[model samples]
Target: MPKRIQSSGRNIVLSVRDFCEREKDNNAPLIPFGNVRQRVAAKTGISEKTLNKAPTLSSTKAEMQNWIINKGLSYLPTMVKAQLYKIIKEHKEAPIYEADQMLQAHCHKVARLPPYHCELNAIEFMWSLVKRRVANKNVGQETNNIVNLAEEAFQSITAEDWQKQCEHVRHIEDKLRERDVYMDAEMDRFIIELNNESDTESDSSSEDSSDSDYSSLAIHMDHAYSK
Candidate 1:
């Protein structure tokens, strides 16, 4: 009806026929994408919950076909199915958080510690020291005594105390690194021995290799605490 209407395209008058001809080559798909329908209102059925409704992983290899069936997708070739899976499981970076912006506004930087590493946290050790001091002084359990003792406990901490806690964390890290090195060496040695045994057995058909050739290491790292 508005075949002669102007101003929408800034000089190109509206033409529904021309628009349909240009878009016929492209079907309306991937509702997340496609054109802006009316320049403002996005089309419906474009939500995350709808897009991510893929099949769950199963013990068998039927999940791929299940995904196709659930999505009403046509039977795809192996290569195309693989590409679809890759797109479905693509690694998406997390959304930018407001915490970063708030920190920048106050001229403060954000320092994130590794997850599940309380021993590596300096503040955790400091809290332990303060709690011990407060427990020793607040024997009467009075409210004011507890508060005063806590304040004194926190004030008693010095630079030397913080340095010791940081040093302790470094020591733990060093021990972990040494243990990793030892484990890697043991694994390499075991693999080499197993391969040699297999080769010897193959060379001499009359004699079978003993199970002891693949036994656990006799000389292991000291385990006084029994792991």
Candidate 2:
């Protein structure tokens, strides 16, 4: 295993020896993510066309607010969240996780989870199982007793148990996909009904206006899938 590096130059090839090892894969040049070397900058000659613009980086909090107002945006908090963050985030390169960088140094690529979404994780379901087992079997609240119970609880959940949970999630996903087909047909029907009669809101809505539950249902797939 390669010695894991802790930080920057996680992305950099500082020396010729590193380049030789890296170049063995292919002749693709190391594209540095940070400031270019003076020699490199001179050769490349900064072009007018840039990848992304960082308009808000240097601005104070007050200046960001002013920019929001000048743009005739909505509520302060909402504008900051919906609009301002996009401007700042789009300009930035995503930071590599320290643990991920360390692992990559050892030639093991990590499979990253989608940020903030865990409904698809079978391990989450397995965790609940383990927790429930521990709760049921609790003999004492002592540290070692709890630790032993937790270990046994984890061991009780086999590979097959995990596979079952994965299949459960898959079934839910299949159902949602079928649900999407229904929603798509409904949306098309809605559009057709809206302009079938008149341009005005009253005429558009009143045309074949039967109660539609799509609005009332408000079926959040994320919430449903978690259950």
Candidate 3:
């Protein structure tokens, strides 16, 4: 958490560690911070000593190395378990959501967007519209005026616009899901074709080796007869 202090009439600098200490001094509820190892151990009921022994398992490189050492298993169940524990720990100890819950009485259901899919959030489009309006207003006279203009831009977005954006997001979600299904089907087909090709190649190689062996045997018999 960074503390923003007004140095001279709106010119502010952020001090992260100092701000946290200052907030602590002010009796602000300190954010809950959990260690990765401890969190994973608690979630999975795995002993901390075991986790410490495989500390590198928390990392992708270490997971990949473990996979290689295990002879290239398609699925490393242990690695998956470790990753799940890490994910659970991260979600449980998220600073913002945890703080929000502590400060607010109302139950918050946080719906997170998929990674790199900001377009799915209608608020993103609404903000773009608001920023465009603010830029057009050219409220550069004062910071206060700029703030007012931005607020005005935000207020200008109608409920209809919000509804439309929601509808668009729904449509995009359906399309994305459809695309995922198509991709999964294509992947399955590809794997089947690959396996068939490999089997065919193996059969061809076996036939070639058998023919070579037969030819060698026939030549040896002819030599014996000639002798």
Q: Which candidate number would show the highest lDDT if scored against the true structure?
A: 1
- The lDDT per prediction is 0.61, 0.59, 0.59
Please give the distance, in angstroms, between residue 164's alpha carbon in candidate 3 and its true position after superposition.
2.2
Steric clash count of candidate 2: 0
Please name the candidate that would achieve the greatest TM-score relative to the true structure: 1
- Candidate 1 has a TM-score of 0.44
Clashing pairs in 1: none
| CA lDDT for candidate 3 | 0.59
TM-score of each: 0.44, 0.41, 0.43
Mind giving the per-residue lDDT tens digits that candidate 1 earns over 1-227? 66654465532223543444445556643223344543122223233333444543331236665555555564545645555565445432243445677798999987767899898888899999999999988777888678888999989999999999989988988898999998787665542212444445554454334454455224443334455
> Could you give candidate 2's per-residue lDDT for residues 1-227 as a string of tens digits?
99997544443334434555565576655554354542243233322223122345565656555545555543356554336655555444454454777799999988755666587677888889899999998855776698889999987888899889999978877887899998787555532223333333363464245344223333323223344
Q: Which ten residues in a row have the lowest lDDT in candidate 1?
A: 38-47
Off by over 4 Å in 2: 1-92, 105-109, 112-117, 139-144, 192-227
Cα lDDT tens digits, model 3, 1-227, are 86664554232123334445665797853333456655444444444565544223455655544534444334345656566445434333223434455456566655667888897998998888888998898744666688889888888999998998899899999999999997777555532112223333455467766565444432112122243
- Candidate 1, residue 48: how far the Cα is off, in Å: 15
